[model samples]
Target chain A: MDTKLAMHTKNLNFFYGDFQALFDVSLDFGANEVTALIGPSGCGKSTLLRCLNRMNDLIPETRSEGEIYFRDQPIHGQEVDPVEVRRQVGMVFQKPNPFPKTIYENIAWGARINGYRGDMDELVETSLKKCALWDEVKEKLKQNALGLSGGQQQRLCIARTIAVEPDVILMDEPTSALDPISTAKIEDLITELRKRYTIIIVTHNMQQAGRVSEKTAFFLNGVIIEAGLTSDIFFNPKEERTEAYISGRFG
Target chain B: MSASYTGQKSYYGDGMAQNIARRRRHGRVWHILFYAATTISILALIVLLLNIFNAVFGFVLIEDEVPPTELAPGGDLESLSQGELISLLEEYLSVGLIRRFNFEEPLAERSVTDLAALVQVRIVNPTVIEAWSLQESLFQSDMIRAEHAAHPGTRVQFRSWLSARFLVSPQNPRPQLAGIRTAFFGSLWMIIIVIVVAFPIGVAAAIYLEEYARSEIWYNRIIEVNIYNLAGIPSIIFGLLGLAVFVRALEPFTSGTVFGGVDPTTANGRTIISAGLTLSLLILPIIIINSREAIKAVPSSLRESSYGLGATKWQTIWHHVLPASFDRILTGTILAISRAIGETAPLVVVGASTFITVDPKTLFSKFTTLPIQIYQWSARPQSQFRNVAAAAIVVLLVLMLSMNAVAIIMRNRISKQRRI
Candidate 1:
């Protein structure tokens, strides 16, 4: 475990209108490592991921109390733009959603909007190649993204995120919508990605958390029940709820 | 369940089979009913089209005292030039008649077609003694020949009430030379103005209402409900609104007086500009409602994707939302313009001149649209006028259908460009 932290949350609470969804969730993501947020449905794992980059602000009447910090400074502090924060911390959704545009444009749009003044063609190519999609889509770069398959579209979304060179990637169930073969490909890609950027993935699959993540956090009822090394959380008993959730006794 | 079904089969005496048969019978009944309904609708449309076409073409019993061929140097007067026709008119007509012709569009300045028409009307003096509808000409031709044999010359041919001459000539009280040129241009002017004034504004308002306005807010809800209600209101009411607003209050602008083009005495605002602005008002609510539906149909996930990439609200709307919805917005606009093109009551309340000889060449020109011309001609007591109105109806139908086809082609091109 490296003591260097990429991002961390301190006693974060979130509300949708009057209903609180996340309560007192504090966790640290190690620099250049993958951390998995494993929880059942309605356990607030995705909600916390959205809060990290202020995506929660898009939902009306949702409020975030407490703080989220990238490096050492709070992301919500005065004079920090949400747009600038999101530029550094990008997100990949549960379902693959690519803009209804050319596959090349889909990856280049983030960079273009964020004022990336460089070789756009090279950026698109490198981003696609980095996500292992360039070989499959090299010939059809100008074709619409919606024509791609589900797995290809998911990979394109990841490529789109990395095109802006974000420091952290927030993936909400990146493989939950994919088939077995696509899921295996993404898990393998995540292992390769861990060397360059910090990754936080929220998933329902406990085995996915065990396979790809160095640190695993178990969430139950809007609160983190246990957070530790993957081996300790999977094999050693810290909380009965953590063991019961991992072993499939009960969620 | 299998054992229960086996036991119950005899208990109810084949009730399961009877129930299935009953359901099948119900399905058959609905299917036949739906089939008959569609057939009736198509049959009604066919009947309507046949009736219009019947009036549009047919036979005419033409009688001329000294036939046109006898007066012209060549048998075909139509092949002559304007100068040659003027010379022929001078050779045939007396000094008094030639003087009267000079009071109107000078014969030298008139088109060759118009001069030839003048010769046929005055010197050749042909009169339509009798006429038959298209249906009669095609089916009862022998009876028509026998019936009109008593008349002089029986100079009857399959004369189309709608002709190339009818399309190019100006509106004449005589249906023989009545043309839709002026009204066609006026309608075209009206549609251009409507598209110009309504499209960008309607789409902007729709985007604001759908993308920016909070639906739960009081003012936004009020605006939304009012727009929906406005779409359903009678077009005549919009005519009245336009009369009060654009026709009266904005008279200086609508009459082109503000542009310093028209004389104040003539700028009463019942001009083409007024009609166009009124029609734009009538079509706006429809365009806005349709555009809102189009913008709404853009999946929210697309917006989320844009936002997740750190794009602002306007950026998301402009980059992703607007482009994806452009095709549908164009469709809505086409439909709205179609409705505006066929509108009569609004143009009527806007004070379209019932009989305007001059084509609408400027915004200040007095105008009459196709539907207005159709309405005016159809109301006349003369049968010829009614037939001519039917011709106008055919032109109007073609205009609308062609407009729809053109718009649909544009939409398909966009779809192919964005094909998934």
Candidate 2:
């Protein structure tokens, strides 16, 4: 594995109010590669993904201990603006949340906020094309995003996230709500995404983890049990618990 | 095994069917109760509306002389036209009841009821003018000319009950003629001033509370709670506050040379600005509460999506939240204004006059609203004045009803647009 790290976490812990969620855990994501975090519900996989850009700060009760770094720069440092961090590490939520605005404006909102005064039309078109949603939505760019189907909305969200030209894209169960065909389309988009930017996805489907990701980390009870190349994690697991889970013994 | 067999038989047989039938009977009883409750509420509303209609459209009675040959014992003048009534009044009534009314004094200043009492006395006692008309009729014996010569005073002076001319003309000190033109104009000015001062401030406060304020401090919480409580406070209390604040404290600024040097206090104790401010305070809470509800009704997902695209908080609220909520805010403002228009207690507490002869031309000028005018005329002891009061009440009700109807139409338009 070429372990040139894109993002690294060191002894990170998180809490929602008084209840601690993520225990002391460390992980590394490689540059230009897809990293998948697989865990059951409430195992802190999404929490860990959110910590990358400090999106968890939006929650009033959420608190964290230890440190996170992007390209060796501490993301949680007081001097670092969360807005700037979020700009660089964009996120796509599990549920498709499209703005009640025009499709074109939805993509342009990010660029405009970051003071991108250049070719807005070109940028919107390019971003939509990158998400593989251009042809489907091209003719009605001025129409409301709500008019799109769920699959189309999800893809539009992805396009909106990438429009800001973020260095890293963090997706939380990106295809969990999609139909099979949309899921396949997203899997293809994710493969294409890794060629230009670092990708981190949290998902439950083992096949998705195997298909799109180069590296896999399996979390259980807020602890990372095993992580290695995707093939090794799936086909020839190191831990007995990993084997039991992969074989469907129990979550 | 025997118990299980018994249970299975009950579940599979007529016993279960009987239980289902009993439940269905209970459901029917509930449905009947729900429908009965609905019908009772609607029936009550209909009864109240009927009461309002009865009070507004009741008959107007005017007294006149009935020719002895055509006279019924208790005569109502419903059958007489303008020409016949003029001839009859000229026959019996004298100048004592036939004096012309000025039609320019404030209805409050002149006691129309007392004047009506005086007319009733003259109706019973014929003056010299009546005797002269009767003698002139006996000599002429040309029936039409005799009728005219007999009641010459009535031909020149009698105003049939409350006519449309009374509404179109200004109120008079004379017992025969008075109208509500000045009072209507005063209310128009008050409403205009209230809308001008209240809308921007109310909407701005709502926007700040709903969109701008970030800290969850106890002070902001208290402000929120106080605003809600203010919405429920009595309008009369706000009138007292406005009297103290706008009339007394801010008197110099409001009633100074800019207001044409009119004293902050009038004989009636109400200025246009004072009445307007009182009404504004009365409706401010309503406007704020409605606007907040409108802003809050905008979907949370819309805001989240805007933020997810790196839009700032202001940008998200401005570009998406406000536009989505604008129609609702406009509808709410119309409702608030309509409520302000119908309020009588606060205007009364502020001492608005029922008898202002001049139309209000400035915010600081003295004014009278419609309800006050109606109240003044209704209090008069004269039966004719009562008819005039009923007519005024109809006008006031029509104005308020039209405003409320406009509010409903605006709300409907907003809802229709929102549906798509």
Candidate 3:
């Protein structure tokens, strides 16, 4: 494993008003590596993913305790702007939510707003190519993004996120709504993206976690049950609950 | 026991057939009821359209004091220049009437079109003694001819009350000469001001309430409830409010005195600007409620995605939320404007002039709207005025529908651009 740390959270606790959603949890993400957070429903995996770039701040009355460090700088500190954090750490949602704009504009909007002054046409093309969508969409760059198929739209979302040139990308169940073929394509894309970007994915599918990630963190009841190399977590027994969840005794 | 049960089932088979027959009969009854309701609604719309069309096209016995040919000696009345029309008016009309008209609006400065209309109205003085609906005019020509013959001095002519001249000429005491020009311009000015004043304020208020205001706050709840209640309040109440707030309190600003006066004598608060501001208040709640619904219709996921991409709240709303809901917001605006266009009670209470000959020259000019004009005409004792009033109603309907159609087309174009 690479020793370079991309991000880490220490003793992170999250609450929606008075209801606690995440307990004291500590996690580390390595640079240029894929880390998968796997758990059942309502285990705070998505909550933890949203905390990386402060996406949870949008919800009213949501508060977080402790600290999240991106490249060893405290992101949740008073002086830090969530907008700046989100610029460097982009995200892909569970469902493919493309802006109701042209395919070219959808990729260009985030980059343009984030102060990207380079050749926009080249940026759109490269981002699409990175998501393996350039050939299918290059002819109709001016068409509405919503016109794409489910898998194509998801890929376009990835293209849109990476267009801003972010260092880390957080994906919250990016393929849970997709079919088998689209899921496979996205998993392959994720592996390819790991070369240059730190990718953290929160997925419910166990086999997907084992297949795509180098490190796997198992979550149960708003707490981290186990965290280790994906191979070790899938094969070796460190926590009984992790084994029980993996072997399908219970979720 | 099993054999006895089988015997009983066979005995009730005839009864079961009877129940099935009754159920089928009830289903047919409900289907007929549904169809009848649809037919009644469509028939009502058709009847309304036919009624308006009946008044628009008709036959009238017109008794001209002086023929159009006699009025315009050298050239056709339609082709005469403003100077020629002015000379013709002076030659035909008595000096006292001409002086009175000149006092109101200097004929020398009026456009050729306005001069021609003045010549037709003041000099020719055509009187419609008798009028018939489109049906009677089309099918009972002999009856109309006999009626005109009995009148002796009148000639039966097929006249469409809704003429191109009817749209351009100003209101007159005579039904044959009255037109909706002044009221049309008044409505135009009022609607322009209403939309300008209400749209941005309404949309901003809606955005704040829907997106920024915390639902848990007591004041937000009160505001939300008040907005809903305001939308349902009778339009007449808005009229009273406009009268008190805009016409009375804000007289100086609305009358344009504070901004340097245009017409001092008539530029009281009872002007087009006051009427426009009043109507803005009238439609503000509607615009806010509808725009809130439009903003709410935007999926939450879109907002989340925007936020996740590092976009600020304003940027997300401007780039995604507003665009996504643009078509619906336009629909709401069109509806609100249409309501404002037809509104009469508020304008009446706010002091819309019953008779105004000159077109509104500025916001401070005293004004009348189509509904107010129609209302005044319909209130007159003459039957001919009622026919003219019906014709004005047709004009109003057409204007409202055309405005709505333009908005709908714009909305469709925007939606098509965003179509998936």
Best by DockQ: 1
DockQ of 2: 0.34
Clashes of each: 0, 4, 0
State the lDDT of candidate 3 residue by residue for B102-161, as single tens digits.
Answer: 899988888888888777767776789888999999899899878987987567888888
Q: CAPRI band of model 2?
A: acceptable
lDDT of 2 at A105: 82
In candidate 2, residue B87 scores what lDDT? 44
Off by over 4 Å in 2: A1-3, A239-251, B1-14, B62-197, B211-216, B256-269, B383-420
Predicted candidate 2 versus true structure: per-residue lDDT over A125-187, tens digit per residue: 999999999999999998878788888989999999999988899999989999999999999
Error of 1 at B369 (Å): 0.2
DockQ of each: 0.72, 0.34, 0.67
- Show the colliding residue pairs in model 1: none
If ranked by DockQ, best first, what sequence of candidates would result? 1, 3, 2
Reference-based lDDT, residue B189, model 3: 94
Task: Please give me the DockQ of candidate 3 compared with the native complex.
Answer: 0.67
| Candidate 2 per-residue C-alpha lDDT over B1-420 given as tens digits, one digit per residue, 9 for 90 to 100 | 323454663335546658789999999999999999999999998875554444333222222442222422343233434444444444556644444422344323445343333333334322212211222233534553455555543332222333576566677553346687877787677778778978888888899998876436678889999999999998889988987887767766556545445643442235787888889888888889999999989977676556655666778778878878877887888788878877788888777876667777766677787778877777776544554566576677667678778777877775554442
lDDT of 3 by residue, A1-251 (tens): 35798999999999999999999999999998899998889999999999999988888899999889999999999999999999889999999999888999999999888889999999999999999999999999999888998899999999999999889999999998999999999999999999999999999889999899999999998899999899999999599999999888887
**Superposed model 1: Cα runs more than 4 Å off:** B1-14, B72-88, B96-118
Candidate 3: Cα lDDT at A113: 81
